[model samples]
Target: MMTVFDRRSLLRTASISGRAALAAPGLLRAQALDEIRIDWATYNPVSMLLRDKGWLEQEFQGDGTRITWLQSAGSNKALEFLNASAIDFGWTAGSAALVARVNGNPVKAIHSFSRPEWTALVTRADTDIGTVADLKGKSVAVTRGTDPHVFLIRALADAGLTERDLTPVLL
Candidate 1:
C-alpha cells in the first residue's frame, strides 16, 4: 500500500525532524525547553499555514512548552532574528541563510519547503530602463541581506556593473 502525505503532514514531519536534531545534544544534558520562538514569513505560505494551525503548540502542549509565533517581514529580518537569538526557527531564503552562515552566524538549514521564483527586476512602464545595464545610474529599492539583493547583485555582476554603479536605496 502507498500513502500520500499532504502539505500539513510534510511540514509537521520536517518540523519534528528539525526539532529532534536540535534537541538531541540538549537531551544528553537533560535540558528542559520552556519555549520555542519561530518566525513566519509572507513568502512562505507553508509557514503561515503551520502558524495558523498551531501545530507546534499542539505538539508541545504535553511538555508544557510555549510556542511563540513571530513574523519576519523579509529574509534580512529573519537572519537578524536568528543572529540575535530572538527566534529558534525562521524562514529565510537559501542565499540569505548562506550569507549569514558565511558571516559566522552558526545557523543551519533544516528543510527547504519551496523553490521560489519570486525575485524580479522591475521598472516603471514609463521609464526607459529596459535592461540591467539601464539600471546603472538608476535608484533601486532593495532590502539588504535578502534574496532580492543577492539577485540584484548577481544581475549587476553579469552586466559588468555593481552597486557602486547604481544608487541602491536600502529598504
Candidate 2:
C-alpha cells in the first residue's frame, strides 16, 4: 500500500529540538537524526504492510537508523502525535490533513496512501435508514477530527443538511 506524509514543524522546532526530518531534507542532513517515528494503524492496511514487511528498516539499516512504530487509533490521534512532536510521520486522510492545516498545524501533504474512499455511513440492516437524507435527526457515532467525521460533514452538506440536523456522538 502507498502512504501519505505530513511534514511537521521543521522550521519552528528544528532549532530547538534538532528534530526536523519531516520538515526538510537539509535539516535532517545537517543533524544526526538516527531514528524515524511512523504511525501504524490496523484500520490502515498500508501502514500495517509497511510495518510487517520491515522495508523501511531494511533501507535505513545501512545508516544505522532506528525505526519506531507508534500505534494510532485514528487520524485524530495521528494528527495529535504530529503536533506534539511525538512522531515524525503519520498516516491521515486528505480531509483530516486539511482540517489540521486549517487549525494551525504546520504540515504539508507529501503523498497519497491509496485511491480508496476509507470511510462511509452505514446502519443496521433492520434500520429504516437508507440514505444520507435519512440520517437527519439521527445519532451517528464518529471519531471526531478523522476521515469519518470529515466524510460525514461532506455527506451531510451534499445532502443539504448540516451537523445541527443530527446528533454527532464523538468517539
Candidate 3:
C-alpha cells in the first residue's frame, strides 16, 4: 500500500513545468502510488543512454519508484510482457508497434525515439544476383511485421514481386 505522499512524488516527474501537477488535483490521494514501478525495454543506444545516465531513477528516487530493467528478446516478446503487466513502459519499433496493435495488444506510442534506418540485405558475392527482382522464388528472412519486413515488402514490390512469389521466413 502506497501513501498519498508517495503517489504525488511518483507523478511529479510526469510534468515538465507544474502544468501536469496543476492539471491533476490530489492525484496521489486517488492512486496511492508509493510503489509505482516502470519496466523498460532497451535494445539500442538511446535506451542505454537513458539507463546509464539514471535520468528516470533520479527523478523518481524521491517518490520510491523502483525502476526495473526488463530484458526483452524482441518486439514481440516486449509486447507479451506489456500485455501480461510485466512491464509498464517499453521501447519498440514502429512496425512492431503496428503489428501488436493489429494483433489486439493495447499500447500507445508516446514518442518516436529513433529515426535512423539500420538494416540491410546481403547475399554471397559469388551469387551473381544484381537486383531485388533476382530474389523471386527465393527465401527471405525477416522479423514479420517489423521494419525489415516492411522494407522487404517495398523492395520486392519495386522489383515487381509479391510475397506469394517467394517464401518469407519469419525470424
Candidate 4:
C-alpha cells in the first residue's frame, strides 16, 4: 500500500495537529477549565463573526470550557481588560497594542486579522476643514490611547502640527 496526500488533506492534518499542540499543555494538567474570557469589539468584524457562529463553543464543547464573551468599546477598553486580567484573549489594533506594550502592559500581538482603514478625521459637511492644517486651533474629538488618537497625532505631525496646535477633546 502507498500513502498519498493532497493540499486539502495536508491543510486539514496541519490544522488538527496545531489544535492538538495547543491543547497539549491543558490536557497535561488534567484539570477542567471553568471558563475562558474573550473580548469582542465592534471594530473587529472577525470577533463578531466568531461569536455569532458559535465556533468557540463548539471547539471546547468536549472539554466543558465556558466561553465568556466580553464587549469592548475600543482598543483602550480591551487593553484595560487584558491588563486587569479580565479577559484571556482580546482584539485590538496594532498601534494600540504597541502603545499598550510600551506602557508596560504584558501583551503580545499574535495575529493580524484585518488591515482595513480603521481611523479617519472627519468634520461637518458645512465646515471648511478640508485639510489637516485646517484642524489647527480646532477642537477634535478623539478617544485617548486609541488608534484614532494615534492617527490624529501622526496626521498632525505630518502636517507640521502638534496636539498643542489644536484642542483635543479627549473622550
Candidate 5:
C-alpha cells in the first residue's frame, strides 16, 4: 500500500530504561555503523519484514556489526527512545516529524516508506450511519494527534462539514 508519511520524531528509544531514523538498505550498508539498532513503531510490517526475513542481520553479520530492534507503540514512544540514544534509527510519520521539530528534536529524513494512507474509520455494516454527513451532531472517536485525527479533518471537509457539525471524541 502506498502511504503518506507524516512528519514525526524518530521512533528510537535510547532510554535509561528502554528507538527507524530509518535508512534504506543501501545507506545502512554503506555506513556500517558499529551497531545497527532499528526502532520500529510497535508491531508493524516493517519490523516483521526485516526481523522475520532476517535480511538486515545477515547483511551485517560478518561485518562485526550487530542488529537490534526496538518496538514502540507510537511515534511519541519512539521519540523517547531516540532521546536516550538507545537506537540509531526510528520510524515515524511526517506530522510527528513536524511536532518533534517544534519541540526541539534533532533528526533527519533519509527515506520514504508506504505511499498509501494507512488509517481509516470503520463502522458496523448494519448501522444507519454512513458518510461524514450522517455524523451531524454525533460524536466521532479519534486519536488526537495522529493520522486518525487528520483523516477525520479531511473526510469532514469532503462532506462540506466542519468540526462544529460533530462533537469530537478523543481517544
Candidate 6:
C-alpha cells in the first residue's frame, strides 16, 4: 500500500523551499564579495570624502571583502582602470564616459556624483581670443581623445563651426 502525503507535509516542504530560495541570492552575494577597488581622485571631492571616512571599508569588512582605493589622475586614468578591470568603479567626466562607450569599453556610468564645474576653456590674457567664436581659424592645444577634446568639439559646434575650421594642435 502507498502512503499518502498530507496537506501539512506538502505545505511544510514548500515553506522550506521558499525560505531557501529567499536566502540564496544573499549567500551568493556574500560569496562573491571578494574585493572592490574604486577610484579615488582629489578632483572628485565625493570620492575623497568616501575614502577618507573609511565608510566603505567598514561596511564590507564583516563579509571579508577588501576595499582598494586607486588614484585617478583624470577621467582618462579612470577609464583605463575600468577598461582593464583594475577597478570595479571609477569617476570620470560625462563626456569621457560617452567616448568610452562609443569605443566599446563595455563600461557603464553608474553615478551622477557631483556637478562641480571642474573644467573650463581658457586663453592667455594677452590673446585676443575672448570667446568660442574667436577659436575659429586659431590653433588650440588639446589632449586628443579626452574630455577637453569633446568640450572643444561642443564649443566649435556652438560657434557654428567644426574641427575642420580650426587647427587642433594635439598634445
- Give all candidate RMSDs, comma-separated: 4.2, 6.8, 8.6, 7.4, 8.2, 15.4
In candidate 2, which residue ranges exceed 4 Å CA deviation?
1-26, 29-31
lDDT of 6 at 135: 88
TM-score of each: 0.79, 0.76, 0.72, 0.77, 0.67, 0.68
lDDT of 4 by residue, 54-138 (tens): 7677777787888899999988899889899998778888778888899888876544544555567889999989999999999
On lDDT, the candidate that comes out on top is 1
Worst 10 residues of 2 by lDDT: 9-18
Better of 1 and 5 by lDDT: 1
lDDT of 5: 0.64
Q: Sort by TM-score, best first: what order?
A: 1, 4, 2, 3, 6, 5
Query: For model 5, how does the per-residue alpha-carbon lDDT over 19-105 read when each residue is reduced to its tens digit?
Result: 133344434445556777778664455555556656566666676677798887876666668778877777776666667777788
* TM-score (C-alpha, index-matched) for candidate 5: 0.67
Q: Where does the lowest 10-residue lDDT sum fall in candidate 5? A: 10-19
Error of 5 at 104 (Å): 2.8
Ranking by lDDT: 1, 4, 2, 6, 3, 5
Residue-wise C-alpha lDDT for candidate 2, range 83-103, written one tens digit per residue: 999988888887788888999
lDDT of the structure predicted as candidate 3 = 0.65
Residues 78-144, candidate 3: write the lDDT tens digits: 7778788887566677899998998888776654544655667788899866788888888878788
Better of 1 and 6 by TM-score: 1
Provide the overall lDDT of each model, using Cα atoms, as 2-decimal numbers. 0.80, 0.76, 0.65, 0.76, 0.64, 0.73
RMSD of model 1 against the true structure: 4.2
lDDT by residue for model 1 over 38-94, one digit each (tens)? Answer: 899887776787788777777778877788988989887888898899998888888
Top of the candidates by TM-score: 1
